[model samples]
Target: MTDDARARGLTRMQEVYGWKPPEIDGAFFATTVDHLFAEIWSRPGLSDRDRRLLLLGALTAQGRMETAEIQIHGALHNKEMSEEQLREIALFLCHYVGWPNGTRLDTAISTVTARVRDGGEPRMRRLK
Candidate 1:
């Protein structure tokens, strides 16, 4: 992270966790966030499908439910994956991973679906 990211994270951390700092180690956090993810993950070469899959696997493995939900919405926003694709992924994880993980996916899907139902903004495009 540059000074900007550090400063921003600092302020957000203070706001969220009362300045205790995230459980993450500080030294590698900057490099990983600022360079590895920000630089590479933003590249156009990786399709939305690929990014969504990556995020689903990573977040599920790490048990990061909230971020995983955001990624589910983001995949939709990017026009990468469909609602069906998300359900399938989660369902697969359910069988291989466990029922609890499957539940996480269901929860995320419900949250996103409700957001759309509540007039969040429709972006689903039917495949012709």
Candidate 2:
């Protein structure tokens, strides 16, 4: 909405995702940066690490491996989680989220962990 919101959103994106998102134009993108990141993610009480864990669980439960991989990368890049912890999360979630979803989440974790360990840069999706 405002420049201030955009600035805060961009800053918060870096804080959360460990990288800068490309400035994109679209209602969805606007809402994501202006509202979701600026307002929701920047909220007090919940640390970024806590929020990330919750998001990871939700993403894994929904079988959203693509986004899960992104979050996994963020967690590792930000040093909020270790590869061991990520694997444990996938294992622990298997019973609750189902074996299939857990397997997908594990794959994502492995992919992101390998990339990060190899010193590869995070892959960014083109937001429309």
Candidate 3:
């Protein structure tokens, strides 16, 4: 990837996550910045908010709450989504993604929403 793309990706990541990659895993970090953020995320068709919502659904469906939490927090932090919207998505997913998966995500969403309303920092910053 070009230096500019890499830089922009890193900036975006930091803006969303409020943290940087550790130096120990530079290659993995570089690929995430260069490919995932710069290449894939920079694509034109979807808005950032749309991507965030889609990612929330995909992550919840896949039962990846750890990662989903990050995306959820990002969505709220960026004001791309609201708690009611997330709750609606969870309810909507129940028919398609199953009740168990939807409930799992709803639990996580509740936790994050409470944190935000209580003026606490997101757990994503503490994630490795």
For each candidate in the order shown, give its overall lDDT on alpha carbons.
0.64, 0.90, 0.79
Per-residue lDDT for 1-128 in model 1, tens only? 47776555555433322223344555666664455445555467876567668778778766778767666766666556778888888888887668787778877887886775585743332222
In candidate 2, how many Å is residue 28 off?
Answer: 1.0
User: Residue by residue across 8-98, what tens digits does model 3's lDDT show?
Assistant: 8877776655456444335766788878887778789998888887888898889988888777877888888888898889999888889
Q: What are the runs in model 1 whose C-alpha is more than 4 Å off?
A: 1-33, 43-45, 121-128
Number of clashes in every candidate structure?
1, 0, 0
Q: Which numbered prediction scores highest in lDDT against the true structure?
A: 2
lDDT of 1 at 27: 60
Candidate number that wins on TM-score, 1 or 3: 3
Clashes of 2: 0
> Estimated TM-score per prediction?
0.61, 0.96, 0.84
| Worst-scoring 10-residue span by lDDT in model 1 | 12-21
- Between candidates 2 and 3, which one is better according to lDDT? 2
Give one digit per residue, the lDDT tens place, for model 2 in 59-119: 9999998888888999998899999999999999999999999989998888888898899
The Cα error of candidate 2 at residue 14, in Å, is: 0.9
TM-score-based ranking: 2, 3, 1
